[model samples]
Target: MECIVRPAQSADCDHLMGMIREIAEYHNLLDEVKINSQVLSADGFGGDPFYQCLVAELAPEQEGKQGQGIGKKLMSEVAKLALARGCVEMKFTVAEWNVRALAWYRQLGAQDKTEAGGWHCVELGGEALQRLAGDRR
Candidate 1:
Protein backbone atom coordinates (compact mmCIF):
# COMPACT_ATOMS: atom_id res chain seq x y z
CA MET A 1 0.00 0.00 0.00
CA GLU A 2 2.77 2.40 -0.88
CA CYS A 3 1.88 5.42 -2.98
CA ILE A 4 4.43 7.76 -4.46
CA VAL A 5 3.48 11.36 -4.91
CA ARG A 6 5.66 13.11 -7.43
CA PRO A 7 5.69 15.88 -9.98
CA ALA A 8 3.87 15.09 -13.19
CA GLN A 9 5.90 14.67 -16.35
CA SER A 10 5.05 15.30 -19.99
CA ALA A 11 4.88 11.54 -20.44
CA ASP A 12 2.01 11.40 -17.99
CA CYS A 13 -0.27 13.50 -20.19
CA ASP A 14 -2.20 10.54 -21.57
CA HIS A 15 -2.85 9.02 -18.17
CA LEU A 16 -3.66 12.41 -16.73
CA MET A 17 -6.05 13.08 -19.55
CA GLY A 18 -7.84 9.85 -18.78
CA MET A 19 -8.10 10.77 -15.13
CA ILE A 20 -9.43 14.19 -16.08
CA ARG A 21 -12.10 12.61 -18.24
CA GLU A 22 -13.02 10.26 -15.43
CA ILE A 23 -13.64 13.17 -13.10
CA ALA A 24 -15.55 15.05 -15.76
CA GLU A 25 -17.70 11.98 -16.35
CA TYR A 26 -18.24 11.54 -12.63
CA HIS A 27 -19.57 15.10 -12.50
CA ASN A 28 -21.68 14.50 -15.61
CA LEU A 29 -19.83 17.23 -17.46
CA LEU A 30 -17.96 15.21 -20.01
CA ASP A 31 -18.88 17.65 -22.75
CA GLU A 32 -17.11 20.43 -20.89
CA VAL A 33 -13.75 18.72 -21.42
CA LYS A 34 -12.43 20.31 -24.56
CA ILE A 35 -8.72 19.88 -24.03
CA ASN A 36 -6.95 16.73 -25.13
CA SER A 37 -3.71 15.06 -24.04
CA GLN A 38 -1.60 17.24 -26.31
CA VAL A 39 -3.09 20.38 -24.85
CA LEU A 40 -2.58 19.06 -21.36
CA SER A 41 1.08 18.37 -22.04
CA ALA A 42 1.72 21.74 -23.62
CA ASP A 43 -0.13 23.69 -20.97
CA GLY A 44 1.68 21.98 -18.15
CA PHE A 45 5.11 21.53 -19.65
CA GLY A 46 5.52 24.41 -22.08
CA GLY A 47 8.08 27.19 -21.77
CA ASP A 48 5.49 29.30 -20.00
CA PRO A 49 3.65 26.78 -17.89
CA PHE A 50 0.14 27.63 -16.84
CA TYR A 51 0.15 25.44 -13.75
CA GLN A 52 2.02 22.83 -11.79
CA CYS A 53 0.72 19.34 -11.30
CA LEU A 54 1.47 16.40 -9.06
CA VAL A 55 0.78 12.76 -9.73
CA ALA A 56 0.17 10.01 -7.24
CA GLU A 57 1.33 6.69 -8.58
CA LEU A 58 0.22 3.55 -6.81
CA ALA A 59 1.40 0.03 -7.30
CA PRO A 60 -0.12 -1.83 -10.25
CA GLU A 61 -1.48 -4.48 -7.94
CA GLN A 62 -3.07 -2.05 -5.52
CA GLU A 63 -6.72 -1.19 -6.02
CA GLY A 64 -7.44 2.50 -6.13
CA LYS A 65 -8.88 2.77 -2.66
CA GLN A 66 -10.22 5.78 -0.84
CA GLY A 67 -9.76 6.97 2.77
CA GLN A 68 -6.01 6.45 2.43
CA GLY A 69 -3.36 9.11 3.01
CA ILE A 70 -2.44 9.28 -0.68
CA GLY A 71 -4.45 12.45 -1.23
CA LYS A 72 -2.96 14.00 1.88
CA LYS A 73 0.51 13.20 0.61
CA LEU A 74 -0.21 14.77 -2.75
CA MET A 75 -1.51 17.91 -1.11
CA SER A 76 1.47 18.05 1.16
CA GLU A 77 3.76 17.96 -1.88
CA VAL A 78 1.74 20.74 -3.52
CA ALA A 79 1.93 22.86 -0.38
CA LYS A 80 5.65 22.40 -0.25
CA LEU A 81 6.03 23.52 -3.84
CA ALA A 82 3.81 26.55 -3.25
CA LEU A 83 5.75 27.54 -0.17
CA ALA A 84 9.02 27.15 -2.00
CA ARG A 85 7.74 29.50 -4.66
CA GLY A 86 6.73 32.12 -2.02
CA CYS A 87 3.02 31.50 -2.34
CA VAL A 88 1.08 32.38 0.80
CA GLU A 89 -2.15 30.58 -0.01
CA MET A 90 -3.72 28.10 -2.37
CA LYS A 91 -7.27 27.98 -3.69
CA PHE A 92 -9.41 25.45 -5.52
CA THR A 93 -13.08 24.96 -6.23
CA VAL A 94 -15.30 21.99 -5.59
CA ALA A 95 -18.81 21.53 -6.87
CA GLU A 96 -21.44 22.57 -4.35
CA TRP A 97 -23.13 19.18 -4.49
CA ASN A 98 -19.91 17.28 -3.74
CA VAL A 99 -20.46 17.01 -0.02
CA ARG A 100 -17.91 14.27 0.47
CA ALA A 101 -15.15 16.25 -1.25
CA LEU A 102 -16.11 19.42 0.62
CA ALA A 103 -15.98 17.63 3.96
CA TRP A 104 -12.67 16.01 3.11
CA TYR A 105 -11.18 19.35 2.13
CA ARG A 106 -12.46 20.84 5.37
CA GLN A 107 -10.80 18.02 7.26
CA LEU A 108 -7.58 18.96 5.48
CA GLY A 109 -7.93 22.51 6.87
CA ALA A 110 -9.43 24.06 3.75
CA GLN A 111 -11.86 26.90 4.39
CA ASP A 112 -14.98 27.76 2.47
CA LYS A 113 -13.81 31.18 1.31
CA THR A 114 -16.94 31.69 -0.75
CA GLU A 115 -19.02 31.66 2.43
CA ALA A 116 -16.58 32.92 5.06
CA GLY A 117 -14.96 35.62 2.96
CA GLY A 118 -17.77 36.53 0.61
CA TRP A 119 -15.67 35.48 -2.33
CA HIS A 120 -17.11 34.44 -5.65
CA CYS A 121 -15.51 32.36 -8.38
CA VAL A 122 -16.24 33.79 -11.79
CA GLU A 123 -15.36 32.80 -15.34
CA LEU A 124 -15.89 34.01 -18.88
CA GLY A 125 -15.20 31.56 -21.67
CA GLY A 126 -15.95 30.76 -25.33
CA GLU A 127 -18.28 33.30 -26.89
CA ALA A 128 -18.27 35.48 -23.84
CA LEU A 129 -14.48 35.57 -23.81
CA GLN A 130 -14.37 36.38 -27.49
CA ARG A 131 -16.88 39.18 -27.03
CA LEU A 132 -14.87 40.64 -24.19
CA ALA A 133 -11.73 40.59 -26.30
CA GLY A 134 -13.54 42.28 -29.16
CA ASP A 135 -14.82 44.99 -26.85
CA ARG A 136 -11.25 45.93 -25.96
CA ARG A 137 -10.62 47.03 -29.55
Candidate 2:
Protein backbone atom coordinates (compact mmCIF):
# COMPACT_ATOMS: atom_id res chain seq x y z
CA MET A 1 0.00 0.00 0.00
CA GLU A 2 1.01 3.54 -0.67
CA CYS A 3 0.81 6.13 2.07
CA ILE A 4 0.78 9.85 1.54
CA VAL A 5 1.52 12.46 4.13
CA ARG A 6 0.78 16.08 3.45
CA PRO A 7 0.21 19.40 5.12
CA ALA A 8 -3.38 20.31 5.77
CA GLN A 9 -5.19 23.07 3.85
CA SER A 10 -8.20 25.23 4.59
CA ALA A 11 -10.40 22.86 2.62
CA ASP A 12 -9.37 20.05 4.93
CA CYS A 13 -11.17 21.53 7.92
CA ASP A 14 -13.93 18.92 7.95
CA HIS A 15 -11.56 16.01 7.48
CA LEU A 16 -9.22 17.32 10.13
CA MET A 17 -12.10 17.78 12.55
CA GLY A 18 -13.20 14.23 11.89
CA MET A 19 -9.71 12.93 12.61
CA ILE A 20 -9.54 14.97 15.82
CA ARG A 21 -12.87 13.65 16.98
CA GLU A 22 -11.79 10.14 16.13
CA ILE A 23 -8.63 10.53 18.17
CA ALA A 24 -10.56 12.02 21.04
CA GLU A 25 -13.01 9.14 20.96
CA TYR A 26 -10.16 6.66 20.93
CA HIS A 27 -8.90 8.30 24.13
CA ASN A 28 -12.37 8.23 25.64
CA LEU A 29 -12.49 12.03 25.80
CA LEU A 30 -14.98 12.70 23.04
CA ASP A 31 -16.98 15.15 25.10
CA GLU A 32 -13.91 17.27 25.76
CA VAL A 33 -13.39 18.13 22.09
CA LYS A 34 -14.93 21.60 21.80
CA ILE A 35 -13.11 22.77 18.69
CA ASN A 36 -15.15 22.63 15.52
CA SER A 37 -14.22 23.02 11.85
CA GLN A 38 -14.25 26.82 12.00
CA VAL A 39 -12.17 26.90 15.12
CA LEU A 40 -9.66 24.47 13.69
CA SER A 41 -9.40 26.38 10.43
CA ALA A 42 -8.96 29.67 12.25
CA ASP A 43 -6.32 28.31 14.59
CA GLY A 44 -4.37 26.40 11.98
CA PHE A 45 -4.69 28.42 8.82
CA GLY A 46 -5.74 31.80 10.14
CA GLY A 47 -3.73 35.02 10.20
CA ASP A 48 -1.70 33.91 13.19
CA PRO A 49 -1.32 30.20 12.87
CA PHE A 50 -0.88 28.50 16.20
CA TYR A 51 -0.05 24.99 15.05
CA GLN A 52 -0.05 22.68 12.04
CA CYS A 53 -1.17 19.16 11.35
CA LEU A 54 0.01 16.49 8.90
CA VAL A 55 -2.29 13.78 7.69
CA ALA A 56 -1.47 10.29 6.46
CA GLU A 57 -3.69 8.59 3.94
CA LEU A 58 -3.37 4.99 2.94
CA ALA A 59 -3.93 4.36 -0.71
CA PRO A 60 -4.41 0.60 -0.80
CA GLU A 61 -3.14 -2.26 1.24
CA GLN A 62 -2.70 -5.76 -0.06
CA GLU A 63 -3.60 -8.97 1.79
CA GLY A 64 -2.25 -7.92 5.16
CA LYS A 65 -1.67 -4.30 6.03
CA GLN A 66 0.94 -2.71 8.22
CA GLY A 67 0.67 0.84 9.59
CA GLN A 68 4.03 1.32 11.26
CA GLY A 69 5.81 2.78 8.25
CA ILE A 70 2.88 5.00 7.42
CA GLY A 71 2.93 6.45 10.92
CA LYS A 72 6.64 7.14 10.72
CA LYS A 73 6.18 8.89 7.41
CA LEU A 74 3.52 11.09 8.90
CA MET A 75 5.77 12.06 11.79
CA SER A 76 8.63 12.80 9.44
CA GLU A 77 6.41 15.12 7.44
CA VAL A 78 5.26 16.81 10.61
CA ALA A 79 8.83 17.37 11.73
CA LYS A 80 9.71 18.88 8.37
CA LEU A 81 6.71 21.17 8.55
CA ALA A 82 7.62 22.22 12.07
CA LEU A 83 11.16 23.09 11.04
CA ALA A 84 9.91 24.97 7.98
CA ARG A 85 7.69 27.07 10.23
CA GLY A 86 10.74 28.19 12.25
CA CYS A 87 9.73 26.15 15.24
CA VAL A 88 12.72 25.08 17.29
CA GLU A 89 10.88 22.01 18.42
CA MET A 90 7.51 20.36 18.47
CA LYS A 91 5.81 18.93 21.51
CA PHE A 92 2.89 16.65 22.16
CA THR A 93 1.58 15.09 25.34
CA VAL A 94 0.58 11.48 25.65
CA ALA A 95 -1.26 9.81 28.48
CA GLU A 96 0.93 7.74 30.77
CA TRP A 97 -1.07 4.67 29.87
CA ASN A 98 -0.23 4.89 26.16
CA VAL A 99 2.94 2.85 26.15
CA ARG A 100 2.85 2.18 22.44
CA ALA A 101 2.71 5.85 21.53
CA LEU A 102 5.41 6.66 24.06
CA ALA A 103 7.65 4.02 22.57
CA TRP A 104 7.06 5.30 19.09
CA TYR A 105 7.86 8.86 20.13
CA ARG A 106 11.01 7.68 21.81
CA GLN A 107 11.95 5.79 18.67
CA LEU A 108 11.61 9.05 16.77
CA GLY A 109 14.12 10.60 19.22
CA ALA A 110 11.56 12.49 21.25
CA GLN A 111 12.88 13.43 24.66
CA ASP A 112 11.14 12.49 27.85
CA LYS A 113 11.37 15.80 29.66
CA THR A 114 8.68 14.93 32.15
CA GLU A 115 11.30 14.46 34.82
CA ALA A 116 12.76 17.94 34.33
CA GLY A 117 9.77 19.68 35.89
CA GLY A 118 9.84 22.08 32.97
CA TRP A 119 6.25 21.46 31.90
CA HIS A 120 3.05 21.39 33.84
CA CYS A 121 -0.49 20.73 32.65
CA VAL A 122 -3.74 21.20 34.51
CA GLU A 123 -7.11 20.00 33.35
CA LEU A 124 -10.54 20.66 34.87
CA GLY A 125 -13.60 18.82 33.71
CA GLY A 126 -16.59 16.62 34.53
CA GLU A 127 -18.08 16.64 38.04
CA ALA A 128 -14.99 18.16 39.56
CA LEU A 129 -15.34 21.23 37.38
CA GLN A 130 -19.04 21.49 38.22
CA ARG A 131 -18.25 21.38 41.93
CA LEU A 132 -15.55 23.96 41.52
CA ALA A 133 -18.16 26.24 39.98
CA GLY A 134 -20.41 25.73 43.03
CA ASP A 135 -22.96 24.17 40.76
CA ARG A 136 -23.75 21.51 43.33
CA ARG A 137 -24.62 24.09 45.91
Would you list the C-alpha lDDT of every candidate in the order shown?
0.92, 0.81
Q: Give the TM-score of candidate 2.
A: 0.70
lDDT of candidate 2 at residue 28, scale 0 to 100:
99
Model 1: lDDT of residue 128: 95
Cα lDDT for residue 73, model 1? 89
Candidate 1 vs. true structure, TM-score: 0.93
Structure candidate 1, residue pairs in collision: none
lDDT winner: 1
Q: Model 1, 42: alpha-carbon shift in Å?
A: 2.1
Candidate 2 — worst ten consecutive residues by lDDT sum?
A: 59-68
How far does residue 67 in candidate 1 sit from its true spot (Å)?
A: 0.9
Tens digit of per-residue lDDT, candidate 1, span 13-125: 99999999999998999999999999999999999999788999999999777788888888899999989999999898899999999999999899999879989899899
Each model's TM-score? 0.93, 0.70
